[model samples]
Target: MTKPPKTAQTAGGETHQSAEDLGVDALTTNHGVPISDNQNSLKSGTRGPTLLEDFVLREKIFHFDHERIPERIVHARGSGAHGVFEATDDISDLSKAAVFTKGEKTEVFVRFSTVAGGAGSVDTPRDVRGFAVKFYTREGNWDLVGNNIPVFFIQDALKFPDLVHAVKMEADRGYPQAGSAHDTFWDWASLMPETTHMLMWAMSDRTLPRSFRTMEGFGVHTFKLVNAAGKASFVKFHWKPRLGLQSTIWDEALKLQAADNDYHRRDLFEAIDTGDYPQWDLGIQVFDEAFANAQPYDVLDATKLIPEDDVPVRLIGTLTLNRNVDNFFAETEQVAFLPSNIPPGIDFSNDPLLQGRLFSYLDTQNSRLGTTNFHQIPINAPRCPFGNFQRDGKMQTKVPKGRANYEPNSLADHGEDGGPRESPAIGFSTVNAATGTDESGDKLRVRSESFSDHYSQARLFYRSQTEAEQAHIASSFVFELSKVGLLEQVPGRMVSNLLNVDEDLAKRVAAGLNIPLPMKAPAAKEPIDMEPSDALSIHKNMKATLEGRAVGVLITDGTDADELAAIVEKVRKAKGKAVIVAPKVGGAKLSDGTQQKADGQLAGTPSQIFDAVGIILSEDGCAAMLKEGAAVEFVMNAFGHLKAIGANDAAQPLLDKAGVVPDDGVTGLDSKFVKAAAQRFYAREPSVRTLA
Candidate 1:
């Protein structure tokens, strides 16, 4: 009487249950017989190609062949990982979403992707990243599908397909894969005045983020959260990088594409493998309906952004990616996400872009998943229990055992119920709202006058950038526009558009293009004047930590062992990585008679791939390195890129050979330069000669 375990009870409420007592048998074939040969498909001949006649073979191969659905038109190239999201703080009052209530630990899957690339495209492309997350909660799965940038190109979802078409490679030529600096994009962007603000972002360093971990994520459209009390609050979701914001120079980004196409992927995998898990703080720009109505622009406009100064961000939780996926196809590729897949407490707004997204995601999945029951895929399946009366679709796995299939059946009266009862009181309920309608219904398909002022935020963004960043932006514009070999078709149109943002920027771009500047900018609602938000500047927000950063260590035949060891130890202590490059790929002999293996040969590893570099040599080794053009260029390129250079007394002649001068970031005996090396050298870039 004192000793019956919970497992001792049977379905009949008897106290004599055992593992061998009663239950369904193990999994079996489709006919409910048994499955023993799942590993091997039956074939007439052992070494022959797969047989088509066998139903088991056909079933497995058909599924495997159709396993790969079409990749997304945008964000085709992606990498993902599995992790756990532990809620550090409680915001139950604001949102009843179980993932963020109290100290709940939710399992999460995150996919990071490039916007304009194919499945086989390079990882370091200059493009916006899709930062989408799936959280498994007790209620259901909550998908926060978002992008790295906060603002979008168009204000309405109606324009999304056209925007994507323009940016994609031209249908006829089929060239310029994963690029936007082509004629079609420029033409469409010049015609669409609303695209002006986002064009600035696309041209800026944000598009050339150094890594996925260092960038921020945003739920580009506004959303709503309903608390337990049924009160709704307007919310804009944000994912702020714990490492702060950082980006690579355009030149460095181009070089990296050739040197290491898998740069970001390798960095992510290694970081997790080394226990340096990437982390981002979850923040929200929460507001009330009153604030949305008081805004100058339409809150539903996807092209607009709520300034951080106007509405402060609330830090509620942190998302740490602590694990990597075991298999890419099983986990990342099969993972399906839709913005419409929200939990009970979370809801969507009337944002046009979001509304369109809700439909587009499902439509795209049909082609990608190849079936209506795509949710049955393990990666996309809900962990919580689910039941429905609907059945008999392609690849149906469940079998309902009952005589009655519909609800409210007479079979239930005979104790043979065939359906589950509905819970209307505890189910999802849409909040009813009424617009000021006169007769027919709520009017649609019209933009409010408040959405017309496009230049104010654009100007604020420009003014907010630091002097170095502003110059980079201007230089980037000049570089991209100059690629438009036809002056009248693209460059002139772009200059005319820039005039609306800033007269001086327009003038400089015109001069660079050798075109006459427009006399005046197109008229705007009010003279664009807004307080500069410091949060908009990436360089200003960048942190001093060198975590996940790399350093190049150059060695020669007579490299000093003590010096190399000390430098490598210091880099490791600062959470930075160091790779040893020797004059030869085989090995390098040290002064202490010790030979160290080279991580890379001088010809293989260029200094452009590292955050900083250090050089050690003997007189003979210096002379040899000077004679080798690759070695000379290694030091020279690092200097030109404004990377911090560390050297010993013997390495002076090599520096002289490379024509490197001792700047503030250059270190000799002291290691103080390590600190400066973490910061990018914006001053030196303008002076460097452009590639001919």
Candidate 2:
């Protein structure tokens, strides 16, 4: 098990304590003396000053003072939930991992995180998301730490610190918090050509995922799977969400960040709480060493990707997040995942980034855990039986009864059993297939020739996007590069890199930036004609139902209760959520004199936060709410975001004020209009205004 990276914070107004929740008598001093009081400081007298002789007081206070560890330079802000991964299909031919054996269910913990924000930062930022999972298998605990994006920025680990330094808050001015729109980032990216592939993904809608349930997870590096016979094969891991991929528009995301900072977390929690558990199918792209060597590019390159067309993903298992954490501090915040935690049959490749990760993980754990025995934390410990000769470190809880710690001792065969003997037939064994010898002193740093062509995959990614999605990518580049203050003609430099991807893309981005298009584009080893992969497009695959989605209905004084009840019943039957909003905070009277209070006032809740909007206002209320700025924005944003808007006859003027054309998305709906509002409006979006 690996300790959490620095930057886990106590949420909101909670205090952080380093000790486990085993009570006062359960906790002991560093010198093995039991502690009776952990809640209060020991004093000279009943209410007197704290005494220096009270080592218990000193230990508690001293630990509290240094409770916070350093945050990760990236992926600081995150949310976690407990879940179970169940094997739905058998894939014993691919590997011998016990967790994937037929008809097995294992406990798992997953953490979803945004890559570039503080722990308390808003959830809907434009950034790559982390999708890390830890599985407690029969053999041991295995961690599959990965990101939503299938590829990474650099091919090697040597450029990791440099990449993070550029993306983090600028050195001189610590402004632009939780963002990447700066001169330093573009400057570094424009110079390093390999970043182009991932930049295409980051600029696309994948970075702005609508919900954690809608995004996919990739291992991002090549790995190996060894069978019981010691035969090894190359593999890649994938987690495809059952709901498919979806993302919010940039304008909607910005507004949602202000309206509800916890949008994604709230959506996930409510979905599980309502028994609509989010699920993803575990997949593996299996290949042999001969096939890996036959590839045009190095399979070890982190910046490159193998097209799914070449090696299709085979689904083997499913993971469902069915439970929320009982305590955020003890479980979620303290849970740790490291790539080095691999069960038998699953092994590592020669990817440089992965090699560096093996060393970086344990070292970073020490900084966060503050002790060598951080694994003793229940969340990090394995559920299965585990024992070894090693013992007695800081925070040690176990006490072996005998002194026979050595395995080969003559006194071990007695009742006091010596350490367990190794079983080679069942134990993990490393594969040794290397032909090159280390004693020849042939070690030298060099980039493989197969990893040189970086622009082909970038081109493949761009060309794979739909026309509108490609336009969004170009617009996103324009928006981010426009914020670079010091770099004049930075757009040209970025577009120059894009020329290697596509001439039309370079021209469009250049036009958006008000610059001249390049004369010619660079060429790739394989021409920029890779077949488009449907998995890459968010707009191409959206959920057709409104389950786990929110709808806001605006009401006013003297509104019809029967009509409101009908709409609520229809939405509820579809597994959708509905919240009421009124012109005033305290709400208004209905036709039957039944005074119902609203969940939020019109000024506080905006229509942009919901998937659909309803205006069930009366004639007088419509005229009154139309005069308010928030009400106008509520209706306008809903239409501009291409959401379904159901209105009453009296609400026509509000729709008119919002400049909403009477289309399919704009309907005079009652119980009958529930069906159309559930599906996404891809056709209606083109008629709306493009913010960029």
Instruction: Predict model 2's lDDT versus the native.
Output: 0.81
Q: Which residue pairs clash in candidate 1?
A: none
User: Candidate 1, residues 151-178: lDDT per residue as tens digits?
Assistant: 8998888899999998888788885788
Give a tens-digit lDDT track for model 2, residues 386-435: 88877788878878767767766766657666766787887777664321
- Give the distance in Å from residue 433's predicted Cα in candidate 2 to where it truly belongs: 6.4
Models 1 onward score TM values of 0.88, 0.89
In terms of TM-score, how similar is model 1 to the real structure? 0.88
